[model samples]
Target: MLAIKGVSRRFGGKTAVADVNLEIAPGAFIGVIGRSGAGKSTLLRMLNRLVDPSEGTISFDGVDVTALRGQALRDWRARCAMIFQQFNLIGRLDVLTNVLMGRLNKVSTASAVLQLWGLEDKAMALAALEQFDIANLAGQRADSLSGGQQQRVAIARALVQEPSIILADEPIASLDPRNTKVVMDALLRINKHFGITVICNLHSLDLARGYCDRLIGMSAGRVVFDGAPAALTADAARDLYGLEAGEVMDADADVKWAGQARPASAAA
Candidate 1:
């Protein structure tokens, strides 16, 4: 289980996430839905130590995740993989190379710096790509692939980390509807098949309802709702998103909360 207790993140004087608490059961698929700047991304980053919380503690199982340092922090990050809105692949490198980068914490610095990955490591990276049905593109440059394909490669990279939890910060924000389905399905498969916990930041209520078993709604950096997807009614969505029933169900409405510019797949 992942436990977040009294967690908060402050940017200068502004609190991005505030006094939040959550318990994530193992292997659960959770979609965190909220307007932009609601601190959805900040919450996920705190789990991976990408950002330190201004207050409170986060623990995985019984380990003190917030206190991890140096090698311990790196190991914690390996155990808790993160995927981002941008694919974050090394654009100049081949897909397989980028996936192999997941093993950096486990491998020697010399080997990584020299790009001297062993044949077994190479095979494992290939296997990860194959798991995502992208093995044939392993030799292709990451920058050459379509957005959906790059996202899959990113997931494959995370899989190579053998993480217990995957925190995806708007993984589908840039993809079209077709690509969104592809990426979301891949994440679902990873969660269900591998028993890896998944916490996703999502923009589309329909997509969140369709994919996540549980939904967490955030507003003003606090969790306003947490329940099964089926319980998120039109009224609940309205409260979460400040949208009326028609706008909530439009499916193609711009949900750029907090006046942020919508992504290319704003209609997603």
Candidate 2:
């Protein structure tokens, strides 16, 4: 289990995340929802150690994740992979090379710098691309693919890392409707087929409702609601968004509240 106790993050005078606690089990699909700047990104960054917590502890299984350093920290990062909104990839490199980069931490620095990928590594990367139905694009430049294809490359790269958990920060925010559905389906497949825990930050309540087994609602850096999607009542949503629940319902065709917390999901 992944356990967080009293976790918080602050930047100068601003508290990005505050006194947050959660226990996430393996193979669970969790969706985190909140308005922009409500600490959702900061929370995920802290989990991957891209940002350090101001106070509290995070533990994975029996290990103390907060105390990892140097190689240990790098190892921790490998175990907990992060997929970004922009689909971070080496645009100049071939898709295969970009996927091979996921093994950098496991290889010697000299070998990695020299780009000495063994046959086994190439096979591994090829297999990952095949899993995403992108093996044909292996020889193509990463920037040459469509947005949806590039996002698939990013997911394949994460798979090559063999991570036990994936933290996706607005992964489908930039994709079109068709691609959004594809990406969400890919994430679901990874979680179900491989038993990898997935914690995603999402802006679309519709996508959250459709893809997530459980939802977490945050307001002003604190968790306001946590339960199965069906348990999220109208009153709970009001407290979560500080507005009438209907205002942010993604299914509402006429919703255009100034505080548009949830928009219609591209996946829908």
Model 2 lDDT tens row, 1-268 = 9999999999999999999999999999999987878789999999999999999999999899999999999999999999999989999999999999888877899989999998988899999899888999999999999999998888888888889999999999999977887788888888878999999999877677777888999888999889987777666766776654554566553343334333322223
Show the colliding residue pairs in model 2. none
The local distance difference test score of model 1 is: 0.89
Worst 10 contiguous positions by lDDT, candidate 2: 258-267
- Among these predictions, the greatest lDDT belongs to 1
What lDDT would each prediction earn against the true structure?
0.89, 0.86
Instruction: Give the per-residue Cα lDDT of candidate 2 at 195.
Output: 92
Segments of candidate 2 deviating more than 4 angstroms: 243-248, 252-268
Off by over 4 Å in 1: 244-268
lDDT of 2 at 39: 89
- Which pairs clash in the backbone of model 1? none
Q: What is the Å distance of residue 47 in model 2 from its true position?
A: 0.4
How does residue 239 of candidate 1 score in lDDT?
84
